[model samples]
Target: MDTREKILKAAAEMLAEDMGAKLSVRAVAARAGVSTGSLRFHFPTQRALQDSLLARIYEHLLPGDPIRDPALPPRERLLNCLRQVLALIGTNEDARTAWGATYRTFIEPEPTEQLRAAYLRHEREAERRVEHWLTVLAEEGALPPGDHTRNLRFLLTILNGLSVERALPTSQSVFLAEAETLNAAVDFVLSAGPASPVESTQP
Candidate 1:
């Protein structure tokens, strides 16, 4: 492999499995089996290397990565999709955590434009899915009719806050309980319509 590619790979590996040691240029070069000078020649600065790595990892964690299950009904599919997104916030070893550390990099006052745009796009896509499905069900009288756009934004805000907060020093129970509250909030919105008997088909 080329020297540039080798250095990038080594930096990524160091960042893997929740290790934060990947930011060191010397360490990264050693891991890549290249001289520190070689790594610096390519990256020039640590910020350049760190920013590039963060972009790659964010793509991996995008909401679109998880395709909806065809076996489930539309509502269930949407709920399951949201569940998967919320799952990103947890500290459980089983849950995805790379996004956590990468997010920390962007918390600085002046994150790069690329990073900011990527985050906004993900946030919008997430809100769109939740708002669209809820709006459809509400119009069909299957779900309680209410202001879905505002509600969807509120729910997503919960997710954003939790993901950022739990990424810091926190506990797993907080995530689980937060997920429960979110699930209940969704259910409550579903039940907001007039009390009328309707046959629901399981997806």
Candidate 2:
């Protein structure tokens, strides 16, 4: 990767690991195998680096809207929607690792204004993503008519809890894989709503 990309990637990895507290120009430069001068050339300040990292995280987390194919069975479409939500946790070890880093970067407390701004930006992006899917489902007659904003908040709340649960030792102790957890969450949402009954086909 180019130097700027390398710096961003290194920063992202650090943030994923909850090393945001320790991030510094020098450390990022070392991690990227670039000179501090080079790092500064691309990102002259920590806020600049942080802004770039936040954008990258959003890009990774908020993948463009899922395909809402009308031809697919309702259950299939709902499962696809749920999987899209669960995808935020990632689908594999590498992805989960990257997600861990992102989670750390997102929730870890920081006093900097830039960090707070980044956090809010990420929050809005997350809400937009959830709102987009729910709206699509509603338009497709998959979701029952109701207050979408409230529904979005409710789902996001549960999703946030599930995300945190995945990071806990208790979840691993119970062998609760990410997919199973997500599937269960999705099932609950689909079954509780006016959405079609879930098919036996695995998500």
Candidate 3:
């Protein structure tokens, strides 16, 4: 494979391994059988490398293009978008571990400024993805007009809570399947913003 492809493949493998959380440029270079200089020559900076890896992971999880599918009902499209978000959070053990590590890094007693900035950038992209889908619904007259930013935050916040709950051990007192919970959450969020006139008047 080409040098850039090799580096990215090595990086993806690293993120799936136990050492994923402790990922560093040096470690990635060593694992890829390339010198640090070669790695930096391709990636230039740690943030760029991290972003590339994240983009790769996201693409694998949701291979569909972000463009809205006009053939599908708009709410179905929204649920599909939100389902992709859930997959990102609770797809597999490797992803769950990586997410837990990311959370730990950010919530440290005094997270480094660099870490905080990088995390914020990562989160902003996720929020933007949700907003983009919602914006499509709004434009198509499938969703009500409202504060896009606030609605984006609200949906993401609920998904975040669900992710955390999924990671925890189930209690005898309370149990909800992921499908049931997700469907209910999606319904509630859609309800908050009244359906567009076109949808409301439909059979």
Candidate 4:
């Protein structure tokens, strides 16, 4: 394989082995059997490397992402994407285990710097994925023109709530409730009017 590809492969393996360790330029270079200078030439900064790595992970996490399917309605496309995120949390025992791990790592006790950084990295990745979905819809004129920051936050908040509910006991049909909630959230964002454009000062 090519030098750049080799470096990326090595980095992906390292990430799979440990989510938050062995990502430094020196470490990746050593793993890839390439010089640090070569790795630097391919990825100028750590952020650049991490961004590329995360993009690769996203692809692996969702191959042939449903968000890119043009045949699906915009709302449906977005709902499908959101559902994929929740699916990772699984259901019943799997969901409980995921929540337990989260509490131990982030909630019960104060998180250390390493733990905090790892959490932030994951949070940013999630934000990036949502932003990309909005951008795709906006490009197709399927989404209204607006500052999507609020919309992004709204969707994520809904998702977080839904994920929490997965581990809880509820009388209602969780699947039906989740579908209705996701549909309502998607409709609310999609039906909103465009943001007001800033007036230009030039005469």
In model 1, how large is the Cα lDDT of residue 122? Answer: 47
Q: Write down the lDDT of every candidate, Cα atoms only.
A: 0.63, 0.67, 0.71, 0.84
Clash count for each candidate, listed in order shown: 2, 3, 0, 0
Model 3 agreement with the true structure over 1-203: per-residue lDDT tens digits: 98788888988887665322445789888888999999999999987887787788777888975438777876677767776776666644645675678666676437777666656766877887787777777787766766577668777887777676656655432234656766776677666764333445556
3 versus 4: better lDDT goes to: 4
TM-score preference between candidates 2 and 4, better one: 4
Q: lDDT of candidate 1 vs native? A: 0.63
- Please give, for residues 1-203, the per-residue lDDT of candidate 4 as tens digits: 99988988999998766655638899999999999999999999988888998888777877778888878988889989999999888987788887877786567767778778877887888888888888888888988755778778888899889998998876675999899999999888788733555699999
How well is each residue in 1-203 modelled by candidate 2, as lDDT tens digits? 89999999888887666543446899999999999999999999877887777667766875653546757765566556666655556434644575567666765555587677656655665677677667677676767766566656666786766555555544234225645765675666555654444479766
**Ten residues in sequence with the least summed lDDT for candidate 2:** 166-175
TM-score of each: 0.45, 0.50, 0.64, 0.80
lDDT of 1 by residue, 19-105 (tens): 435357888888899999998898899877876665566567743522244465545655665667766555554333645455465
Best by TM-score: 4
Candidate 4: give its CA RMSD in angstroms.
4.4
Provide the lDDT at 165 for model 3.
Answer: 63
Error of 1 at 121 (Å): 2.1
Model 3: per-residue Cα lDDT at residue 98? 54
- The lDDT leader among the candidates is 4
